[model samples]
Target: KIETIDVTPLNNEQSIQASLKAFAQFNRDPYQDPGTVMRHPGLLFLSEIGEVKQQVEHINALKDELVTRMHTLNARARNTHVKMAWRGVSALQLYRHITAVDYAPRKALFSWEGRTTSISRPHSKEEFIEIILKTKDMCPAHVSPLDWDDILRKEILYIQSVQENGDLVRMKPVAPHPRLLLYKTTDVKATDTIFSNVPTFVKTAPDCTIVELTSFDFSKTTTRRKKRVFIPIVERLNMYFRPFK
Candidate 1:
């Protein structure tokens, strides 16, 4: 079972302090009031922004052994290159709630090629989001979805708490799932995701602060046809370059 790490008692290393200083400098907004920034709809996210390397290193320092263990597990399972998906800091203020929903590949949940599945009928992304939202209402705020028999019969969902300072929630790499976090007290949090076997290119900006990935990838089974196999990757790369143009 995965458990949250309590970093409150741990002393910050020199490198961590330096990284935090740089991060604060880069993310500082002169126009916004410091008092109200957390209340804004667009909360500052720590990932994919300034200094990807620095951010990853910061997270590693926070939980070095756990990060190494994840890399080892991914290598054993996927036998492919491992990459940092994203890493960042989150400030969860008191009484703030975050909700997460499980994400499955659409092909897994919806019927395809007229082959009906037990999960549900074919639906678009919008419809799927609607279904998930409805499910969120089915349970009380404090109850975890794992306890809901009806939801469990069809899908898996759960709620976990990370209320204290230095509490780290670790999730294994399995399927892409969303999360909901409720902060009972003000807490500064760090989170990261590492992925393997994802076919895409990551390029940092000229300043070496921001990292962006080509959005397209092979989500389907490979075919013997050369054109079909390679065209999508070419197109995806082309798409990634469009911003430069």
Candidate 2:
């Protein structure tokens, strides 16, 4: 039988630090009965006990300093308009960063119909925003808005993405040569959705790489239908990957 505990509320860096401190204190002054210690002379070694207590005291001092620094950081982190998101192997990784709760890892939370493929590695902050703007693809209905706001405000700070067959990357401009992914099928239909609905290539192709399509039907489709859309294939589809090179 498998049991799952929801630790989303309890997970966080500060909480984990507190737990460690408590564990250290327990080890330093272990609760063994006096009678038991008397029976086993080796258990009551004064020098060893003193050393453990000294180490525990040192840890406590460090923790006190850490608390002060954390308070200062918390103060500075307030009212920040900029936000970031990370794409990793699982949402648990993202959640852990957000909440600081220690729990068993779960499957990727940002998925559709329990089916997911080809995680995105956007090339810039705008690209990341665009990815999240796709309400149908990424939004979690079960999570409360307040919880999400807190998570976004506190936990997420950098945008990490996956690209080129799971190579860990971020949405930032890099020097040398830029890398990107393209659509596998040149025959992308007008009816197809962006990113999620359409299939993308695993490898990054060249710039201005146009995919010539045969006669396509666009009649009957009125709203949100583009007569002609230029999908960037060689580089990132966002401003960062725009053909300025």
Clashes of each: 8, 5
- Name the runs in model 2 displaced over 4 angstroms: 1-47, 75-138, 141-245
- Looking at candidate 2, what is the lDDT of residue 17? 52
Determine which window of 10 residues in candidate 2 has minimal summed lDDT: 36-45
Error of 2 at 110 (Å): 38
Give candidate 1's total backbone clashes.
8
Itemize residue pairs with steric clashes in candidate 2.
11-99, 11-100, 11-101, 12-100, 12-101
**lDDT of model 1 at residue 44?**
22
Question: What's each prediction's TM-score?
Answer: 0.15, 0.17
Q: Candidate 1 — what's its lDDT? A: 0.27
Per-residue CA lDDT of model 1 for 1-245, tens digit only, reads 11221111112264355434433332324463322222211112222433544544454464555445555664335232222322122221211222111221111110011111112222333333344455554776666766654653333222112112221211112222112122222233312122211111122222222222222223431222222111111121121001111
